[model samples]
Target: MTDHSYEFTRAITRRPGQSITRGLRAVDTGAPDLDLMLAHHADYVATLREAGATVTELPPLEDFPDALFVEDTALCLPEGAVLMRPGAPSRLGEVAHMAPVLRDLYADVRVIEGPGFIEGGDILTTGREVLVGRSARTDAAGVAELATILKDWGRPLREVATPPGVLHFKTDCSLLDGETVLSTERLAASGCFEGYRVILTADGEEAAANAIRFNRFVLMAAGFPATAERLRRAGYEVREIGNSECAKLDGGMSCLSLRL
Candidate 1:
């Protein structure tokens, strides 16, 4: 099946710095508290470890307000790592910082050098193929470039559309297993996951859609009880982490780490 997307042996996470209070947001909900964010981040990393992953925790990058959202920096696959070209200008330097780290681990690391832009958060690699959403942070050219890269690894890339106003594709969906997906109704309604089993987030608990299925646990943002219970009932080991501060910055479970 060639699927390592959900079952990961390791993960990379960065601590949230004081500058995270100034992180980018679609709407200014409120400023994130560094203390609260750090606490939540710790829980997130610990949960990943508990799920049987060797988590590499990196120090905070104060200069990059959104650096804690490491999932946007690169796509970690069984084949190798693909460094992303973020659409956000301020986030470009983040890739440079992550490059060395990934190079140390992967012998075949590739970069997206282009007039186009793509972020790892916009990508979803299922068992059968890789799906990429063209969102505000990911363009057609970037998707094309990524497709070309994946082709060499004998992977298929399918271009999809991110729901309007979403920060990234994963902000509305996640792979649950080889053939199932947990997604917001709005995104599933788009017919993007046609052949896969789709579990829609409980109505009004849409934010819960941005969850991740790590090795043996489904890590989700705290506060969405309905969605959490829904997943539990569906036979997933659910772990809820405090995400109040990260939520304030439009960040969620999947944004905190890059699993490989």
Candidate 2:
């Protein structure tokens, strides 16, 4: 039997560095507080460990300000790991750094080798298929390259569009389980999740959409009580983590790690 997409036995995360305050963001709320981010990151790693994942905590990469958002560099799957070619010029080099790390963990690691760019943040794997959303950072050529790679692995790839202005596809949604997704109404309205069960974030808590269902726990950003309660009422064991600092740079629970 295939492992469910969320059933991860391990995860890879990087510690926040002093350069994290310079992480990219669509809207600069303000510079992130590095001390606060580090404390919160510790809690995030702890939560993942608590959920039974053997977390690989990589050292901080000060050269890449957004290096801590490791999810954008690669896609981790049961079959192998695929390195992404980020659309963001500054983030392109981040993939090279992650390649060796993934190589150390997987026997079959592939690279996008793209003339087009894709980011791991724009890809979401479900029990049935792999969905790739074309955003400002993930283009058509990139999706096509990814589709070709996944095809070789016997995984079907579906092309979709990220909501306009959203940094990444997952910025507006996340897989809750094999067939269910937690999403913002705006993205859900796009009909991208046609066959899946969808749960919309609370009217004023759209930020809560980017969550991760890791093992037995659904980790979400703290402070979205309505969304958290909605998840709980749906029978998910939810854990909230401080996201204030990361939020300033448009990072969230799902952005912090690569699980496999």
Q: Candidate 1 local accuracy as lDDT?
A: 0.91
| lDDT scores in order | 0.91, 0.93
lDDT (Cα, tens digit) per residue for candidate 2, span 1-260: 54568998899999989888778999989999999899999999999999999999999999999999999999999889999999989899999899999999999999999899999889899999999899999999999998998999999999998988999999899999999999999999999999999999999999999999998899999999999999999999999999999999988899999999
- How many backbone collisions does model 2 have? 0
Candidate 2 residue 144 C-alpha distance from true site, Å? 0.5
- Candidate 1: regions farther than 4 A off: 1-3
**Residue-pair clashes, model 1:** 0
TM-score of 1: 0.98
